[model samples]
Target chain A: MSIAWYLAVSGIVFSLGAFGVMTRRNPLVVLLCLELMLNGANLALIAFSRMWGNGDGQILALVVMTVAACEVCIGLGMIVAIYRRRLPINVDELRELQG
Target chain B: MSTVLFFLAASGVISGAVGVVVLRNPFYSVLALVAHLVSLAVLFLLLRAEFVAAVQVVVYAGAVMVLYVFVVAYVGGESDSVGERLRGAGGTGSSGSSLRLGGAILAGALLVELLIALLGTGLEAIGGYGAPYSPGPQSFGTPAYIGKLLLTRFLLAFEMASFLLLIAAVGGVVLARRRGGLGEEDERDLLTPLDLMRPRETGTMAEGVGGRTP
Candidate 1:
């Protein structure tokens, strides 16, 4: 119930997401990790909102949710298109934009 | 009771998040992500952000996760090869060990930074950090309260969000669409040169030429 506990949990989850993003070879898995990171931030926002006895944090969390949805849609659309063009979905092999 | 629920949900969130990152299969990772989102929604409810919690469940867990599942299925299930490659490359070699070591160091550094920022600062550095926990007004996080705020203080933002979502929907449809000239002979003939150049390419070109020729 304490703010510190929530913040600690958020930090751990965010770090895990970062690690996954760094290590995962699959772009889809990377996107999933990004969602984990976003959820971590949302958790912190709501916890702070509760700590402050206000609704602003929750409202911002809602906005973050919307942004996340948009990101996932565009991300998955790109992934699908790429998958269609290439049989395998490997982030390492997606070096065509390395210029 | 609330504290107990928070602890339970927090554990669920953390464990599911770990599963998402640690799972080799994208399908299982998606499942873990769903669990993580749902537990986070529960945590939101415990924090009294009921409306946000509902939105989290409905939008994130229900809709967004379904989209992810569809994509995972569409991309051919169980990309075990990718996982195998990652592990093979990231293990049993000096460079791989160094990379793992670097990742661990980076993660540890982040953990320390967050702990220092959250615990050492005593909450005042973060605006509204010291606000007394009063649960404010009877309708604090109810749908009515959020709706009022959305329509009044944040009306423009709400409208912009909707507009953004509309654009995203159209963009997704456009990006997900298959090429329109797939059935056209002219387009096929045009692509024949490229297909001839790379006959072994494993993609739409190969499929198109193979289907047409055979």
Candidate 2:
């Protein structure tokens, strides 16, 4: 019962992330959407783990949190540096890197 | 009842996610993202993954979002410029259009794959592996177990992660200071003549120009 709710919520989050990545030009917004996607997946894992009555899911959630924190630190650093360099923070501006 | 609640939450999440994606304004996207995060956290609770849900709210909703909001506020001007620049992306000459097309195609394919995988996986019935396995009598969900896992088996990893975070914190402070830097240095004597002309320090220049000056 609860698993169904989790799956549904996760699905929504994933879709939102996919949509954000697709449409939003701002890299920061894209990053936020990506975080949403990851969080959704974490919720799914936890839900399934709970349904199965195991600690594995909880552990996985812990790992996810650690990874999320690391990602935020690294991601923010890059964002700030890019801003300092006066590089475009938009996806459209990132095309300069392409051949 | 549970199924109904799950369906409702799922719909809420999906719509909010759509808003996150389709919304042109970054602020709206953030709002949608928050909705999605909160819904997912609630769903975690429903699944009996109580600890996981709590951590999700605390770490993701609390910490991560705060960081994101800070960055967004800092980049307010850049984001407005993005709105102006987005106009250039409509024509065929622009790579933005191509990338957007490619991204759409890829996202669609991935979504289809997810749906297929979810539908195909036979995880409908809860605790299908005979009876729902319960933990040992003494092994109820407790902070002790998690703490023990972190401090004992994963102690090295735990400490290493903390060390990494320390590095990141120091790095952030350094970068922030550099961004708004002001430090005094005597221009004339910061580097003396001898210091600047060390042969080894200047590499081939020592043997080249200095040696040739008769």
Give the DockQ (C-alpha) for candidate 2: 0.42
Q: Candidate 1: global Cα-lDDT? A: 0.82
lDDT of candidate 1 over A40-79, digit per residue (tens): 8888888788777777888889988999999999999988
For model 1, the stretches where C-alpha displacement exceeds 4 angstroms are: B80-94, B124-138, B180-214
Residue B39 CA displacement from its true place in model 2, Å:
1.2
Clashing pairs in 2: A16-B17, A20-B21
Candidate of highest DockQ:
1
> Interface Cα RMSD per model, in Å?
2.7, 3.3
Candidate whose TM-score is highest: 1
What TM-score, computed on C-alpha atoms, does each candidate reach?
0.82, 0.73
Give the Cα error of residue B164 in candidate 2, in Å. 3.9
In model 2, what is the error at residue A37, expressed in angstroms? Answer: 2.3
| Worst window of 10 by summed lDDT in candidate 2 chain B | B125-134
How far off is residue B40 in model 1, in Å? 0.9
